[model samples]
Target: MITVVVFFSGSGIGTSTQMQHNNQASSSARERHPNSQIPLPQSNYAKHESGATRDSRRRKLKKQKVRPEKRKAGNLEYTNERNIAAHVSRGNKDRPIHKFKNSFVCYSNNARTKAVAVVKFYPFEGMDPERKAHYEQLSTNLIAHTRFQNAKKSNENTLGGTMYSLGWRKGFEEKSHLGITGIASKVAKDQEGWIKLFTETPWINDFLAQRFQDISLGMYREVKEQYDQQKAPSLTPFYMADPESFCGHLSFTFDNFYNKAHKDEDASPFRFAMWIPINKQTGKLVEENLQVEGGEFVFPEDGCAIDFSGFNGVVECVWKASEHPHHTLPSSTAIGSSDDRLGLSCLLPDSAERAIERMMAVEDGEKLDWTIQDLGHLHNDSLKYDSKGKPFETNDGVDLQASPPSACVLDEDSSTEPDKSLSSQLKVATPTQLHRST
Candidate 1:
């Protein structure tokens, strides 16, 4: 018996003259919070909504008409060499930055895959100054609320920082505890501030939708197909549901950060992961400054890097992170100097694909009436099934291939006692959660 469980709600760039001061401010903010365990910033983003209100928000988001600009494919800047083998580094210190003379889109020389693309584009080029500032302030607060625990080091110990994963991720039975389809990563407060940030930040969403229009539309279609809008109303995505989100996961890296070459698991090679660098001081977007140095996006595997050191406006790197071994040179306020820098990347995780596979396996005629909390009894391994109708085994050593009749089985004695695990107790609204109309 597959016990049905509840579904949960799920839940930019800028200018110049405005650019210089913004970076300075961001650096200052990082200085103030340097490793301090301050409380999460208050709820200045959005108010908690009832289910009815959430429905209203969804209708509004659908009707909004935001379109992305059409960039010419002719502007692409092609590189010379193709790297077929994996990149080998000798003590992270030997990596060099590739400095380009002009701003252009980078494409690896490989005729076969064309796996990486680094474009020099400014996300907030034409936006209003005040509005851009508002976005920055909110971002700064979000950064301040975050406390880095372990320094996520790449290349052994060459580059590292306090990393925070904010959006939806694959459900782990022992970790997330909910064996259901997908779950949101935890934030500072009971997700109050985080939810507000997701809902209130429409400008950011619109920018992402516009910048990666094709990917956004593709993800929207995939989501709709997996969870029918009418049948799985509880699974409605957050913000303005339309194409506000292109990917299911977001990762933020705060001050003292650089990446050693690495590949993301379950990443989509066909879809690009969007990377936006921010000034750690103001939480504003990272503007290009000839005087500022470092922060070159390097792909050791490809023997190339996109140097953001001297660009005119802002820079955004859209690359196939799942297919490439990439890293970044430490960014600073000036050449050979150190300062706070923040980075964010957006991608759809493989776990989500697994979750969707499980969800689609359910009989179409059945109504998904379960709540998010009820998913605790489901096992992640049982969530995915082989084409032969056998459940796959997860790393947790759950013998799911034994052909158990029900995926969710409570041990004989605990059915009445009620297991009080953390997964079964969560109740919060996220961007992914949508309301069902009464």
Candidate 2:
């Protein structure tokens, strides 16, 4: 049976930065935490909405207008390499200090009517004090998690992206959250070494707690405030990865993992989402964004590509997954250095947090009249699928295939679940805004 869940955030929904600190990434792999010494981001970013602000369908967009204290941030310093950032007090009173923060620009598919925006604040967002605090807390939480114990390195430790996941394998089964038995190998295991950072954050539940309504509506408010448009689509944002952390992948020499052009999983919200990455050496907790040499995100809907190689931190208003075909260039072919990639991600707003609570309810057997979009388990760590959710071949021109692991961490042949890739080929169902079941 296929269930579809759709949550829409309408015009009556509520609402919810910028500047540059051109600080280069640090040399050491030390983690960062909240300290009084850190300066706040300098941007005039404030958003407020009430019931009175219902008609967003015809709202008009204004250029980036900053207040007295706020200044438009400088462009990200493009470099020959990539990295994320934390604090290293120069203590030089004469020199200006720069910390990472969020910034955005508004746009439309046709450059005319309905508008959407790209919101970015990754590696850091210094402008909003509240969000900055949350970033600090999140850093601290991940740092603590990574310190728990030594990890068993996988035998397949080879070249490619080094991302990891911390959730159960049976994502669609009842009590699936309890199914945590699984093993990772190769580049994934390398990334898994830092997996605790995601599994142990204090607000992880808040991140995973988003529902369709929260996402669709949040996108609405972001675009509404920026473009003053009357209508926002019901874009249900799901974590690019399942209820887990797909920390990151470092595109190494000859590794075909980072170059392919494709889309991310369908649940990702295109308008106003954050893309945060960190230095592989900086430990798991810190968010030190990298400006990868060739990692420019290509947008199909708009025919544009953004190069993060120069940007300090990322906070973009991306296109909805359903509407766009996005891909990045090959990561720099460099050996282990500050450019080596790794990072944690996800920050669900108020609406999405409540959706998570409702998900818990559904798991608890409270039947609601909602369409359950079943985005069957894609095994987030696999290199087989490109960012566009399409199959990819390695540098050797071979398709890398592996079965999803069993809940008990058994061999490939031991998988107890059916492969959704085959099931999806059968045209599973009419995918809802919420999820697409296998």
Candidate 3:
């Protein structure tokens, strides 16, 4: 059994150390009193409890037995860190299935003080069925309202694609990388339903933040501080499910989503991904009543995968994405155009804080309309410029100075309504195009 190691509170006492000490003490006592019978120590509450009360407590413990399906060893495979590292180095190619029985915290072997990853089951612990159904329905609705772009480059066997992202993004000034800044990723004009869903449902952000804090305290503190700093007064476009989410960005994907093995080397350590299966017919959680077989989140490096079919509610996997190379296996049962699984990921890029700071510091009127081409890192010396600060034709014969802005840029004293026009101008490229470009 791959048992989870539970950490105990207090300064120097470890669970294993305490158990070993107790065992040793018991052995020593038995040696000294070979013929004597030693009475076992009892808890104060147990000693004072009535017979009926004790009987009731015993019955309750007995009723909470582990279910047989959860006990199936077919779902779990365990491997050590060394093996995992080796697999990653070789370019992860194999898919391993595992049953997710319990939530566990993975600490660094070299530095036990650092918690590198966490896997949580039933993240929506206290949510009643009705509430779970509501979230499931919202997820389905989001899928309907938004358009998914193909992730062609790293998709598994072309059975992939169907991915999209939302939140703050970094880009440079028009025709120049000198003024790199952050902005909110916008959806298409027709996708107003998706925008309204997030604006109207503020609790969704609260739920994400609360649950994020619940699993990892240290990570939550750092992320919360970053978000608070980003909320400072600014004209920088802020479009997200929740501006306060520890996740500066979110990506949603659907329709038999499966990706080739890869690592998000640029992502921050504070990252989490979720999978919620919805029934196509009823738009409700599949749960145990229905099954969406396969679509396991596989960690080739770890030699294991999280099979969601065994999960009754949403499962959130938080890990060091920069270090882990993972992919997914296609769903055997829920395949084709009717794929019902909805996937979500909360990500913070390693450069997110710096980008947000740059975006916030920019004064209202100086910001320019940046196209997707300006987002890449470019050297200032690479472009030819005259003494008057005017750009010349590049080596490729492309005139940077002649490039047109994606939207209309009006003067400060223009007759048009500034607020409405500025807001409309801010919606540069739709998320579908932006995601594909990224």
* Best first by lDDT, ranked: 3, 1, 2
Q: Is candidate 1 or candidate 3 better by lDDT?
A: 3
Cα lDDT tens digits for candidate 2, 1-438: 734444446543322201111232221212254342444434333244443453442242122233211211211111101122212223344554232233333234222223233434444535455554554454344333333222312314323444332322222345332222232222243333333333332244344223111333445434334221211111111122222221111111212224344443432333333344444344232334443555444443444444455555534333454454544455773455444333332322223323334443343233343222221232343344554445567799887775544332112222223234523443322322332111
All candidates' lDDT scores? 0.44, 0.34, 0.50
RMSD of each: 28.8, 25.8, 17.5
| Per-candidate clashes, comma-separated | 24, 54, 3
lDDT of 1 by residue, 201-285 (tens): 3444445445454333333344334334322212212211233344544566655467677876644443333344456555666
As a whole number from 0 to 100, the lDDT of residue 389 in candidate 2 is 40
Alpha carbon RMSD to native, model 2: 25.8
TM-score of 2: 0.36
TM per prediction: 0.48, 0.36, 0.53
Q: Tell me, by lDDT, which candidate is best.
A: 3
What residue pairs clash in candidate 3, if any at all?
75-98, 75-99, 76-99
Q: Which residue ranges in model 1 land beyond 4 Å of their true spot?
A: 1-97, 108-115, 123-138, 141-159, 175-195, 201-203, 214-244, 270-293, 331-339, 363-438
The residue-by-residue lDDT of candidate 3 on 1-438, one tens digit each, is 645456866544356766778888988999999898877778666689999998998887775564322222211221111112111222233544344555644444422244445566674557776658656755765555343122323323335647655444443344421121211122222233333443423345556666666555566676566555454211122332134456555667766677778777444556767777676555566665334667877666665556676566777666667777777788655334343777787766545545434533544477544222222111122223444334566799886553333432222332112123333444422221101000
